[model samples]
Target: MQQREEKQLESALDSLIQRVNDLKSSIAAMIFKVENEYETLNWPQFLDNFALLSGHLTSLSKLLNHDKCPPLRNLTVLPLNLSPERDEQLAQLTEGRVTTFAHDLVPDYLRTKLEPMAESKMLHFEQKAATVTYENAQKQVAAYQKVVSNIWDIVSKTREEWEVESSSRGNTQQHSSVSDTHLLVTAIGMGKGLKPNPNANGAPGQPTGGMMVPPQGRPGSAGQGPIPPSTQTMTMNKTPSTIKTNIKSATQIHPYNR
Candidate 1:
C-alpha cells in the first residue's frame, strides 16, 4: 500500500511537470510572435495578448512549484528563463514579477511530511499570485493615465491657440470699425453734397443736400439737429460750474427715464 501511494505521487508529479512544459512552450510561442510584431502590432491588442500569455505563464509557474511536488525555479526546456533573480529583473523592465518558490528538488518519502509541505507552498503561491495580479493591474492603469494626460495636454494647447486667434480677430474687427467711422466722419465734413438738411422741401428748385435729415416726432428719433464740429470743442472748454450744471440737468431729465 505504501509503495502504491508513492507510485501515485510520482505519477501526479510527472503529469504536473508535463503540463508545466506544455504551458512554457505556449508562452514561448506567444513571446516570439510578440517580438516579431513589436513594431507593427496594435498596442491595445498586444496588451490583451500579453495579458493572456502572462496568465498562462503564471499557471505554469504555479504547477512547477505545486505543493505536492518539489519546487523547481528553472525548467530545463522552458524559455521563460524563470528564476528569483531573473524575475526581479523582469519586474524592473515590465513592472511585473514572476514569483518562484525555493525548496528541495526532491519531495519527502513520507506522505505526512510531503502533504504538509505542499499545503504551505499552495497557500504561499495563492498570496503571491494575488499580489502579482494587483501590481500588474496598477502598472497598466498608470500607462493608461499617461495616455489620458497626453490627450488632455493636446486639448489644452488647442484651446489656448483658439482663444488667441479669437482675441486677435476681435481686435482687428474693432480697428476696422473705428477706421470706417473715421472715414464716414471725414466724407460728411468735406463733401458738401453729403450734408444733412432739415428743411430740404421748404424751397422749390432750391439746391438740397444729398442726404435729408429725418423729420422729428418719430419714436426713437435721434432729435432734430446734426451734431456740430464745435460741440466737442465747446465741451472741452466748459467751466467747472457749466459741467456741474449739465450733469445736474442730465440727471433730472434723462430721455430714457422719461
Candidate 2:
C-alpha cells in the first residue's frame, strides 16, 4: 500500500511540475500584456496569481520529496534540473493534453464525477505550492519585476545627473572662455581726445553724442600720470590653465616627450 501511494504521489508531483511549466508559458502572454502598460499593471492581482502557482509547485516538489521537508542547505540545487530525462518525464506527466497517468485504471464512474475531489486536491496543492513557492522559487515574478524597476530607476537617475553635470560644465566652460576673450573698457585722461591719455589708465569714453574724450583726472589720482596702455594690463585677468584636467588627468607625458 505504501509503495502504491508512493507511486501515486510521484506521478502527481510529475504532473504538477509539468502544469507549472505550462503555467509559465501562459504567464508569458500576461507578461506581454503588462509590458504594454506597466503603469496600470495589476501587480497585486498578478502577484496573487503567480504566488498561488508557485505555491502549488513548491508544495508538489515538497510532497514528492516529503522525506526531506526541512531543506538541509541554504541553496538546495535540485538534482531534477540536471537530468533531462526526468525533466521530460515531468513535462509530459503534467500537461493535460499529454497526461499519461492511466486514468482508465480507476473506475469510469468515479472518474466521471470527481470535480469535488479534484477541486479539493487542487486547492490543497495550490496552498501547499504557495508555501513551497515562497521557500523554493528563488526568483519570483515580483522579484524579477522589482529588479527591472530598480535598474530602470538607476539608469534614469544616472542619466539625469550626468546631463545636469554636463550642462553645468558646458556653461561654466563657455562663461570662462567668454570672460577670457571679453574686454572691459576704462578711461584714462590724455592730452587730446583721439590719442592716448596723458593721465588715465585704460580706454577713453564718449563725453558727448558719438564723441570720445579723455577721462578727467580726479583730485585723489595719486598714481595717475602715465595714461599709457601698459597700466591697464595689471587688472585684466587670463583664463586658468587647469580647465582641461578631467580629459587628460590620467595621461602621462614623459620628459622625453614620448
Candidate 3:
C-alpha cells in the first residue's frame, strides 16, 4: 500500500511539474514577444498565449489542491557532492574560491528572522516623501504668485507715476507759456507812447537836427559895464529871433527834414 501511494504521489507531482513548465514556457514566449517581436505580434497570437498560460495555471492549482499532494512546507536544501572537476568549474564560473553550494554561501538575511516593522517603515518613508513633494510644489506656486503680484504692482505704480508726472509737466509748461504771453502784451502796451531820444548822437552817415548858438555878448568885451535898461530889453527880444533863425537853418540842412 505504501509503494502504491508513493507512485500516485509521484504521478501527481509529475503532472504538476509539467503544468508549471508549460506556464513558464508560455510566460517566456510572451516576454520574448514583448521584448523582440512586439511590432509583429497580433491580438490573436497574444490571446492564444494568454489562454495557454491561464490553462496551465489552472491545472497547477488543481494539482496543488489534490488529496495526493503533500502539504507545502519549508524544505532543507542539501548540496550535491559534485566531482572535483565540476566543483572547480562552478567555482571558476562564480569567480569564488569555494564551491557554489557551500553552507557559508547562504546570505545572512535568509538565515535571520524578517522584521515585521520593516514594511511599515518603508510605507511611512514613502508617505513622508510624497507629502514633502506636495508641500514644495505648493510653496513654489505661492512664491510664483507673489512674484507676479509684485511685478504687477510695480508696473501699475510706474504707469500711474508716469501719467501724473506727464500731467504736471504739461500744466507747468502751459502756465509758463501763458505768463510769457502776458509779459509780452504788458511790454507792448507800456511802450506805446515811448519814443527814441532825438538828441542822442546819430550814427555815421546820418544827419542830426541840433545846432550851436553864439553867446549874447560883444566880440572883444570881456569885462564891460552893465548895459542900460533899454539896451538889455532890446538884446533879450532879439535873442529869440536869432535862435529861431539858427534852428530853421539846421532843419533845412538835415537830410531827414526834406
What's the TM-score of each model vs. the native? Answer: 0.25, 0.21, 0.33
| Model 3 lDDT per residue over 76-96, tens place | 434565233437676775456
Better of 1 and 3 by lDDT: 3
Give lDDT tens digits, candidate 2, residues 1-258.
878766765676566667667667757756775787687778786787587667766756665566633332332222222321223564565454432323342343224445787989998988987777554566676788899999999999999999999989887743345443333222223323244435454345313332354454653596444344454454343223344554355455544444
Q: What overall lDDT goes with each candidate model?
A: 0.65, 0.56, 0.72
Task: Name every residue pair that clashes in candidate 2.
Answer: 55-129, 55-130, 56-129, 56-130, 188-200, 189-200, 190-197, 190-198
lDDT measured at residue 59 in model 1 versus the true structure, 0 to 100: 72
**Top-lDDT candidate index:** 3
What's the distance in Å from true for residue 187, model 2? 83
Model 3 lDDT, full chain set:
0.72
Ranking by lDDT: 3, 1, 2
Model 1 residue 71 CA deviation (Å) reads 7.6
Question: Which wins on TM-score, candidate 1 or candidate 3?
Answer: 3
